[model samples]
Target: MSDHHIVFIPAAPHYLPTEQQVSSAKAALWQWIPEAEAIEAAVTEYVQFHDCGSNFEYVRCHVCGQELTIPQWHLLMEQDYDLERGFGLTPQTLPCCGNVASVNQLDYSFMQGFSRFSLTAINPRTGAVSAQQTELLQRQLDHPLLVIYCHV
Candidate 1:
């Protein structure tokens, strides 16, 4: 069976929660975020979360509408390496078409990322936590949050 995870990260690197803070955040998550199962702190710089079974076919070049291979997409992701801002792979020059494009520009079927913490809700009935709820959680924790979708 496939699984979907909505990983949450702090907007700033410095905003990453401390161990004690994680506890408080866990409480907030349980109280507010629907289907929140647990809050896990990352031991490494980034957590490599991947899709369970979906294969990434290809991504279209935002510039020339060219359909590029998955490896080409990975090249773009490698170029834009800022993960602290949530969606790490921001817009950059597409090697395939040489045009600036953001992650939102790519038509990708799956996503993965490195994060300092993850709030996992196993097979949540609601799919994902809402932006409003995340915003509220951010306020409660006094840290801006970035949410990324992962299927595994």
Candidate 2:
């Protein structure tokens, strides 16, 4: 996979749609272009990393050869947080991996909030570190203000 930056996004759970919206949402995202590339599990970890912080962008699972994408975001709006307070703080709407509702527009904000993280490559195939992949991911992580990473 080509290097895609791990940029922060502006979105909360509410911004997403419902179950009926999953197919449409994914389809819409596919059209937006692959912002980043990673497997489903990596996506899950990236989501979790946002809550605390992760060591890598895509974690290798030793058994699976899939590369997970790391999700790093700031100015996180909690489930019950007031929306108006963060009304104009987003840079854009990103694909929700189940936690979010839907992505609509792109908003770019200079302010930072909630959590910040870095996405690294994990080998899932051997739970080993891919130095090559890590370096590629590190570059993407450096661009904190990017709207999307080139989906490899």
Candidate 3:
């Protein structure tokens, strides 16, 4: 069975909203997509990549626009991943342009990102979020958010 998820993450990988902020955001999301199966919010100990699952395509350098192949991306991720601390999210030189960029800074084809905190809705029936709703959620969380749709 396939499943869909609507994920919202703060733009800053290290940002974690306060409990009140999270509750406000959750309330806003529930009001916006009341039919959703479930809403889950989490604040993690370290920055973690929130991928778009099967919706993922490719990642490219934000500065140079050079595509980073899956293998190259994997190598970079492996180098940065720490068993105890999670991803370092540090800058690495791109093989194509020699420009430095972090994995979190890459342009994901499917709107994926890295964050220490995330809010996700399971099967929100409603498709993409509207611009107005996005803005409202941002205000509730007091942080700019990245909306990601994941299919699995």
Candidate 4:
């Protein structure tokens, strides 16, 4: 469906910070997550080169109570896939099928990432993101959909 047009950038590759860095950030930053576990959650995000800040905002759905604003999720499978596991891993499939006949699925070819992008709704309950949330990544990053299908 047209609602799944927005392309959200997933968390970056796995990178762990040293205890010193974490402690230093905690001392300097205002909202430092205090606990190590809480700090790790935000550290391993799929931030993109385009995104300015580190923190991402997401709201929960009032109806189904599912996440609908994922800044980025992982595509489990890929031709250049690796075995090493990380934090926010996901299947290498698009959120098509089911009741909605999405055009961004295997049936239709992506027009070099051009088209339209609708902003995703935030889910408040759980910190999960949905496919409906998307914003045009960039004109230069356009492709035939298959290349970076679920990477963003």
Candidate 5:
């Protein structure tokens, strides 16, 4: 069987909300996804990738909009990662456009990203979140948000 996840991450990769804020966001998430099997928040010491799993399609350059091959992206990922420290998110010159950007800056087909913090809903009753509902959660966290849908 496949597992589905709704992962909410801050727009800034390193941003960590206060405990009270996280609690508020949790409450709001429960209200929004009442039937979810579980909802949890995490603050990690190192950056973690929030990926779309089987839903991932492609990655595109933000500047040139050219498709990036898997190998190209893998090389970049390797350049940015560390065994003890995780991703540094350093900017690199793109092969296609020569534009400098981090992996987090690229356009993902399924909203993948790197983050040190995340709030996740596991197997929610609903798959989609409305813009208004997202806005409400963002307000609770007091930060801009990126919502990722992952299927595994």
Candidate 6:
């Protein structure tokens, strides 16, 4: 069986939702991503989030325009980078072209990270929510949001 998760994180790493904000965020989630089930809000001191299993395939380097194979990308993900400490994937000298590259500079279609507050939707059958929907929700919640894809 395959499981999917759509996790919503704050756009800014330091942003934490208040109790009242959680309630409003939940409402916005329901309205925007109606297919989501068991929508919940969580506040974490530190969380290690990743897309261990998902549809993402390859990531292209922005510097050299070279694509990193799955194994190559997996190697990068395996590195011990602490998200709680505000440390994310660091830029590395690419083997393909010897240019400095980071996850942000890679062109791929999923999100991953740790944050203080996460608004989650479990097993959303419709796949990812649209950007327009997220934008509207962000405006309503008064917080920029990051949508992440995860499978466990």
Best by lDDT: 5
Ranking of all candidate structures by their lDDT, best first: 5, 3, 6, 1, 2, 4
> What is candidate 1's local distance difference test score?
0.58
Off by over 4 Å in 1: 12-15, 33-37, 46-68, 76-93, 97-114
Clashes of each: 2, 26, 0, 22, 0, 0
lDDT of 1 by residue, 1-152 (tens): 67655566664433456676666666766665456454454534553333323544456765687787767776666665556643454567777767787654565454333445555544454556777888776775678766666565
Q: How much is 131 displaced in model 4, in angstroms?
A: 25
lDDT of 4 by residue, 36-126 (tens): 2222113322311222122233323323334433431122123223344322233233332123211121221221111222112212122
Q: Each prediction's TM-score against the native?
A: 0.57, 0.23, 0.97, 0.23, 0.97, 0.70
* Reference-based lDDT, residue 151, model 5: 97
Q: Which candidate gets the maximum TM-score versus the true structure?
A: 5
Stretch of 10 with least lDDT, candidate 1: 47-56
Q: Each model's C-alpha lDDT?
A: 0.58, 0.29, 0.91, 0.25, 0.93, 0.69
Model 6 per-residue lDDT tens digits across residues 1-152: 88777788876655776777778778877776687767887876654444535656557777777888877776765563565453364677676788876554566655555466787888777766888878876875678887878786
> What would the per-residue lDDT of candidate 2 be over residues 72-120, giving only the tens digit for each residue?
3322333323444433333333333323321122122221222222222
lDDT of 5 by residue, 1-152 (tens): 88899999999999889999999999988998899999989999999889999999999999999999999999988998999999999999888899999999999989999889999999997969999989988988899999999999
- Distance from true location, Cα of 79 in model 6, Å: 3.4
Worst 10 residues of 2 by lDDT: 40-49
Pairs of residues at least 3 apart in sequence or in different chains that clash in candidate 5: none
Model 2 whole-model lDDT (C-alpha atoms): 0.29
Superposition error at 84 for model 3 (Å): 0.6
